[model samples]
Target: MGIFKKPPLRGGKRNAGVPDDLWTKCQCGELIHTLDLKQHAYVCAHCNHHFLLPGRDRIELLTDAGSFEEMDHGLYSANPLGFANYERKTADLREKTGLNDAVISGRATIDSFPVTLAVMDFKYFAGSMGSVVGEKITRAIETATREKRAVIIVSASSGARMQEGMLSLMQMAKTCGALSRHQEAALPYISILTHPTTGGVTASFATIGDINLAEPGCMIGFAGPRVIKETTHQDLPKGFQTAEFMVEHGLVDAIVDRTKMRTKLAELLSYLMPQPSLSGQETLG
Candidate 1:
């Protein structure tokens, strides 16, 4: 019998589709190695411009190793509106992004301070809030309320999913209601807004957190600048709706750098949930 040999990859590389080396260009016209970018939490090292961080990566960055227990992994979109190509588009997005929906909700600990966490992945349909996404977030908040844990949501969305129509719009109300109950329980809720947190999302739970922190230079508003400009027909002020502008106007509590996000979050969590003493007594402050 003759020995068989496997065919070489089409691109003459072991990993055909994957590039061995990657370089990212910053908006400031600087190029940096991708590994270095990851080291800096995807922020531009030179200009300090914040880049889009994946939801999974964000969770890993903030939580202790092996501390995240995902809550609603099986919940998925069902094409409730029966819109054109809605099912196919959703299926394609699932295969492309490896996400059940835009939002991933779960239980996580920041420096051992337990909290209910939900992160929106923009790669999945612009991180739009659909029925499933809204349901998962609402459930996460409810879970936090029942467990007496803090709730932290990292939002990076363009708005409600248009394909789901009013179904998606209603999620705004549902999530807000859940957060209201969580608030009444006296539990801390932190909302972190990344670039492009807009539309119905801004109108609802995104702005209702006890502490709202936004990434540097992020665009956050109910509508885009062009839409507002056209509607109001007024010359908008410079830096309007940007994170810095919002912070200046007292809209956002602070603008956090991506590199120090984990440290800042851990610090906040520690302040919100002080550790018990060796004698097992927590001092109520």
Candidate 2:
């Protein structure tokens, strides 16, 4: 008989003095402490997997401390089509997430460069865009236009909310219309496409950025690959919907490392901002 029976350790229990919730296993099979993972901006150091950032976290990561001034609050979706149990589900999510909708729109300074920011919260119903999400984004863009500042929208969504029916689908046109005016004003509209930015959102304003940037390994597509495969009955190209793929195919402009995004945005904004015209020296037609 063994002198001591060994306790069977499984899953994260393999480590001692580490709480299960404080640690998570990455897709690359590396076990990382949550604090350390957070320190790395939730990227898997081993495989460079970019974990999705929540809307609020994204705002903090991109904007200067205390520089964000939020607008368009308390706009929640109603049961426009009266989808069964949708109101109950939305109410539950609102209570859980403390957000009235899937997107947070406001003004903030990125590296002291003024911008109107709208970050989509995937935790809220997969970051689905319904009436409120569309309205908030439209308002944000219009506000930026009036203020003569740049616009930045970080998208992390599966698609439009199904419960709202046509109302949800209509956001595609509404947001695009707002962006058209912003473009006409010569103000930059930067769209940061994150993991799983797909469906109607992709087909709309997500891909029309003046400078569209995406995170490494983000999935940007109108439909899931599986559905495309099933529909076409053809062998799919490897990693066809990834951010890298999108860049190669001209869908995305560039892929930025999550950690470097703030610096990059500042640099871009600096370059995009009109030069002072050599200290009042002016000429031209």
The list of candidate 1 runs beyond 4 A from truth reads: 1-21, 274-285
lDDT (Cα, tens digit) per residue for candidate 2, span 117-219: 9999899999999999999999999988887778999999989988998999999999999999999989999999998899999999999999999999888
TM-score of each: 0.89, 0.89
Candidate 2 local lDDT, residue 264: 94
lDDT of 1 by residue, 70-108 (tens): 998999999777799988988999999999999998987
Error of 1 at 204 (Å): 0.6
Model 1, 168: alpha-carbon shift in Å?
Answer: 0.9
Task: Compute the lDDT for candidate 1.
Answer: 0.88
